[model samples]
Target: MSDLKKQATSMHKAAAGLRAVGHRTAKPLQEFKAQSHDLSALGALGSLLSATSEIREGMTTLTKLTRQLEEEWEAEAKLIGEVSDAFDLLDVLIAAKAQAEKG
Candidate 1:
């Protein structure tokens, strides 16, 4: 082969080899990108789980508070009923006393 032709062929082969190396290098980058995407999905899933946990905790606290308020309401209603009955008894006693004095 002519010297110039052999030199050009050698340069071409080197360039082809470099392109192959570049392609090989790109494989890891692509894998890294895929892994990064999966990590992002995992992060999003973790955030969703955290949000759900917070909501569950809030619901539990609300349920407990509601039960406490219901108990307080029941107690207040019972006290009001007892006070009303006591007042009724006082009225009857007053009427009896007045009728007895009218004799």
Candidate 2:
């Protein structure tokens, strides 16, 4: 396999792993949000809840970006395969040209 193809495969795997982690975190974040409402009555707890909400939003955005990256990496892997195929075809043509010259 070409270097580009290998790199694409690595990137795709990493993105997929990160996406899975994001999904795992999402459930906990939802639960936290649900439980946090009870603590809203406390004085300083309001600030804590606000910060947690912001963090949750940021996590949600990051998860979405991770999913998008995973899709992009998958597409990149396919493109790399196409490039490898093109290189193989070029190699065959070059070999044929050399053979014809020898004849």
Tell me which residue pairs clash in candidate 1.
Answer: none
Candidate 1 Cα outliers beyond 4 Å, as residue runs: 1-49
1-103: candidate 2 lDDT, tens digit per residue = 5454455556556545644664666686566555555444445764766675665566567656756765675666566565656656666676788899999
Q: Which stretches of candidate 2 lie over 4 Å from their true place?
A: 1-49
What TM-score would candidate 1 get against the native?
Answer: 0.52
Alpha carbon lDDT of each predicted model: 0.54, 0.61
State residue 4's C-alpha deviation in candidate 1, in Å. Answer: 99
lDDT of 1 by residue, 1-103 (tens): 4343454455545445544543454566456534533444445665776654554455556555655655565565555555545555665676778899998
Error of 2 at 60 (Å): 0.8
Q: How many clashing residue pairs appear in each of the predictions shown?
A: 0, 0
Best prediction by lDDT: 2
